[model samples]
Target chain A: MRRLYTILSAGAVLGLAGPAVAQNPGDTPAPAAQADPATGSSNRARSSQSPAGGLAAVSGEDAAAAPARADGGTIPPAELKSACERALRDDAEWREALGRQLTGALLASLDQRVDDAEPDQPAKKRKLEPWVEQLSTEIERKIHQRENRAIQRNNNHVIMAYAALWALVLGFVVFMWNRQRALKAEIAQLQLEVEEAAADDE
Target chain B: MKQAMYFVFAGISVLLFFYTIDLIFYGTPLDAGLYFNQKIFYYHVPQAFVLFLAVIVAGVASLLYIKRRDGRYDDVAEAAGEVAVLFGAMMLVSGSIWGKAAWGVWWQWDARLTTSLLLWMLMVGYMLVRKYGGPSADRLAAGLAIFGAVNIPLVYFSVKIWRTLHPEASVVPGLQGSMRTTFWLSVLLFQIVFVLLLIARVGQSRIQRQVREVRERALDAGLLD
Candidate 1:
């Protein structure tokens, strides 16, 4: 039951904090520890007590980005850029941590199974590394698919925006041009009428 | 000479448009969270600036028309009001697209967006009154223009006054590096475009007024039935 709870907790952590952790390469080791529920509380305390340098990386970036976020809520562009770069670079680190935590739970379950197995049953070789590796690969693939979908959505939004802007501007210009043409024709027609009226008066 | 000057100005505006487009796409760095989507800011914010400028111009000209009772002032007011409607529509449309990209929602009834929508609607009302309000159309639109001009400050300060999805005015002042340069260049470009459009629209308005006067005289003289 404890193992089941641990696996579920790890999944919850990964789902919530995975991308955040991947983007903070300079973060102290507190995150890796926090990723595991067993040591989360104690590790958080240790990190809080650690010297300022341990948190300097994140703090320094935040300081640089402070002006852009003075309004308090919006993420600044520079910080976002740096975060994206770090996420791209340290993506493997996050996947490794996730794999370790997930497989850690699986291994614990396997250990219980071994303990309950008869002494002779344990003599049969059980290689679990390949299965663990395959599971990790599947998770990574799913994450990549989700990221791609998000990126595609962003691209679509941007293209539609630019298209809408240009289309509207062009439409307005055409409207003005057509109005000018119609007015010019009316003016020409009015001038002819005035000329004919003057001839009739003479 | 005036026609030559207008052509020169148009040429320069075209050149600036190309130059700024290159700078926006290539010279400026990608912003963090929105990535390529943030590029919309280069166009969106500048159009907003032009929108405000047009509305203000319309209000001031309308005030002059009311005080002086001059048809030229009315012409200027009408031209500026038309430009305001054009740019206001652009601002709202682009802004909605940006909201969709950044906030995952196309429209939010937040303070800034709501106020901007109101301002745009007022400008549309100005145009509609001008088209169908008979001889008093100019006066009615001028009134709407003054009201819209008053609304400008509300839209400009909406983010500060209330919690909103739109960025604060400080965001422009806070920009740094290439982002700052690109942003100002975009503002300049949009302003030039606004001036050109205003001049063209004003010229058209003047001609329309002349045509009306000429037609009225001919009718008084029994030139046509």
Candidate 2:
């Protein structure tokens, strides 16, 4: 439960950290979860209400439904599904963050669907692994593709700027050296002419 | 001393080569939002500082020329003006690239940008007046430089005064952590390079002036070919 709260906090913080902090190009494999500071499983029920992200939003809705069931009433499945979808929409801020959080919600929805169809939680977990793995692989590939393009564009600008600075400095140096050489040659010519005129007079 | 300056300048160039590589690979990561192309900021701002300093040095020398009419002060003013123009061109071009990246436009008529352009043009005008203003060209150009010197404060403060797209002079308040250190270090390197260039330029200008004076003397003594 404490671990769940940490994931929730990371999702919220990732949304708030803005887009720049969200992607670290290629090497950083999702460091967004480090912001979690939750401890103690006693607060398990409250963790769902802790603004963790889309998953917590759905979990909080389930907690709400529990009280409704205790009062001898139940939320219709269709209505509950619509509410969960709306909650996910509001909670997920970044496309990448949404993809990550929705995977959990999707897994839960799949487990619920599998249970309804087969009525076996143990076999259902086995069936879910392949789907989860496939989704994770696809998500990672998309993220790397987008971030690599951004990194490449940024690298181009950096190359252009550095080239320009060195070019300007070297160009100025060459110009000054040529100007100095010309002036020295002119000075030598003037001195030679002055000496010839003096010798002619003598 | 001039020879030592040339060696020191070469050393600084070597340092800049490695420093720029580090900046490319490990400098403060690009601003993720609207300022993604701010890698150029490290280069642009420092160049602007040295450019402004060169302008001020030339302006002061121009004032000295105006006061005593000394040919030495005139030579220094001309040398300083040319150096100022050189760095100023680099700053303006680099700045345009940064602007195009960040602001989505290569040029803007906003307060700070316009005033900066005006200042560059004024420096170029100072050079032109020296080149073609004929007799008493130094005095005329010196007067033009004094006017340009007046515009320096206006150009610097324009963003603050008129609320331009350009950030204010108080960007110091926003800097934090290693970025602040990196910025100041780059500034220090640019100043070292600026001093080296100024020394070399003044020496060359002195030699050119001596050549001109010697040719005038030889012609006066009927030494023409």
Candidate 3:
């Protein structure tokens, strides 16, 4: 009885911890090139993100990517390459400063500890200041938009995973069903043949 | 009555699957960082739960078979082991996709992940032994099943036991709103599917055994000669 209890308990524990799941790897181990992600009071508003913050990060990534147009017009074929490169370098330092600022803000929020003894003190002490909140909005919006692409990609991966699972499961079922049908049919035929032979001998 | 029960179970399973779809799309937005890959949470974690339960069922059934030496116990053990391997493989695949999305790698030898892999391999080995081992295959595989069962706790607790990137074991921690509802509902759906699959597999095993017995009877009656 004790042994049986152990097995069930193991099962319960496994479910509680199954896959050790949900905390995103992106959040913990690999935070991507963006500054560590930080949230503010569960404030999920478009205004929470900064447009310039996103453009700054994207521009960094865009340094390697192609530049389609310069100043709303196409550059001469020969100058296009250098023009795009120049544009990439343009304001890069300032944009980087923005990214850094956002990163610092996130880090700061993380370092702040809420006063547990005074339950209401947390909101007063740890709450984002107005300026910090504004900067956070820009940073968060950029992060959300950028991460949306990642989310879409992960969504695709999830779709693929689900497809693969269903395919394998359905395949197993069909395989078993066919095998069983054939065996039952063959066995029935074999029994009939044996009965016929026995009758003939008698 | 049994067939009606099977149909009822299948219908419920299908209904639950659709219900899960509703929850996934309508569930509240996940916390900032976990939003995207968090979608996998619905399927991946539930599948993991199924894997864990299947392993336990296999282990317990195998243990019973070892003690009683009953063919019925053996059939249940074999059925449960096969389901474990199925769900375990799915768990690994789905998890690798998640790891790639989150960690930027397809595989990580972290404590929870590694131990889960080992447990999966152990379950696979348990099945292979039944399929290929000598006449003592049942007993041999039974012993291996017990081993697989014993290792589940280690796999489940490995994140706690080691320094690992895998998330800690709070299956329901901090989940307050729609996220909580979607999670438990998904789990229930998977459990139903798990039961349906196990019943089908065990019935197949029983049918195969009956066929073999009939063939032996025909041979004994001199009809095969």
Candidate 4:
């Protein structure tokens, strides 16, 4: 009996740990039990009464028939408690079957959670591996395209700016150099004319 | 010796410019925000600074010329005015290109931009007045230079006084790390360029004046008609 208590207690702890088996008032799973082919035992009997009630159901063999009162009324609290105590005293085969059923339910709940976590993507991810690979390749190609465009534009602007700057600086220097040259020529002509006038006067 | 020094300085200025350009493009890390377009700032702001320098020099020289009626002050003022115009053109052109790259527009009529445009136009007017304003051209251009100098403060502070897309004067002060170094180097390069141009211009102006004086004396002495 103590060993049966230990096993039932472990099932209750593990059932609460499961994602689907843990529930609130509105979040309770459907209150039904179907035979599990792998375990050859009935499914979890979730109680609409409360999440604790569902967890209590997981701890006993009476879970399969506990909700079925003869007059179609809800099980009395005291009777439900006595039924749980009776299930603890059930035979070893019945207890082991209950353990197997709980294990299968926990595993199923885990699988459900995993399925919920990722939907349609895993299979598609494998089947569309090449398409996704090609899509990434296209994305990388587009990024490089944009980068090259920016580089070309930058080169044009920087080159133009530098060229314009040099052009202005050089243009001014040339202008000044030309003016100096013209002034020198004019001064030479003036000197020649002055020499001619001086010669004539002499 | 001074002529040789000037040539040496010019050579160094050219070499420094190439070195700074390499540092600006290759050595300096790109601005995280502006990226490629921010490179224009290295030259643009420096040219603007030189433009302001030229304007101030022109204004002060013109003022001195006005007070003393000295031809030397006028010559300096004339050289400064030309340099101001040249640098102003540079500032405007580079600024426009940067604006197009950064702001998606080549021009805007905001306070700083408008005032800068006006300042350039005023300098242009000064140049025009000098070329064609006849005997009184000097006095008129001198007044224009004084006006332009006064407008400099307005241009510098326009971003502060009014909300504008153009960056404030605090940009230089806000720079950090290698950006600050590269920026100042560009400024030095431009200043050297400005001084060389100004010296060349002043020398030419003095010679022109000497030639005119000689021609007048020759005519008066009946050496030549």
Best by lDDT: 4
TM-score of each: 0.65, 0.66, 0.63, 0.67
Q: After superposition, how far is residue A22 of candidate 3 from its true place, in Å?
A: 34
Predicted complex 1: DockQ: 0.38
A1-202 per-residue lDDT for model 4 (tens digits): 9999999999988886765444333332332322243432333333222333434446556554557677898888799777765774566577676656564545444444447786754554333322243455556866976896686467667878988987999999999899899999999999999999999999
Q: What does TM-score give for chain A of every model?
A: 0.34, 0.34, 0.30, 0.32
Enumerate clash totals for all models, in the order shown.
2, 1, 6, 0
Off by over 4 Å in 3: A1-154, B154-163
Cα lDDT tens digits, model 3, B58-173, are: 88988888888777877888888888888888888888887877788999877778777887888889888988998788899999888878877766576546656777665567
| lDDT of the candidates, in the order given | 0.76, 0.72, 0.72, 0.78
Q: B1-225, model 1: which lDDT tens digit per residue?
A: 988998898899889888887887789887878777888988889998898788889999999999898999889999988888889888888888788778989898776777777778888899999999998888998888877787777675764466655665547888999999989988898898889889989999999998998888889878865
Q: Candidate 1, residues A1-202: lDDT per residue as tens digits? A: 9999999999999987988777566433233443544434323324433323323333458545444556778776788877855764578766455446444544554555667887665333334542443455556866986886677467566667777876887887899999999998998888798888888888
- Model 4: which docking level applies? acceptable
> Model 1 segments beyond 4 Å from truth?
A1-153, B154-163
Candidate 2 lDDT over residue span B50-128, tens digit each: 8778788888999998998778888788888888888788888888998888778998877667766777888899999
TM-score: model 1 vs. ground truth? 0.65
- Candidate 4 C-alpha lDDT tens digits along B1-225: 999999999999989989998988887887776777789989999998888788889999999999999888888999998998999899999989989888889998776677677777878888999999998898999998987788777675764466566765558998888888999999999999999999989988888878988999999999998
Worst 10 residues of 4 chain B by lDDT: B156-165
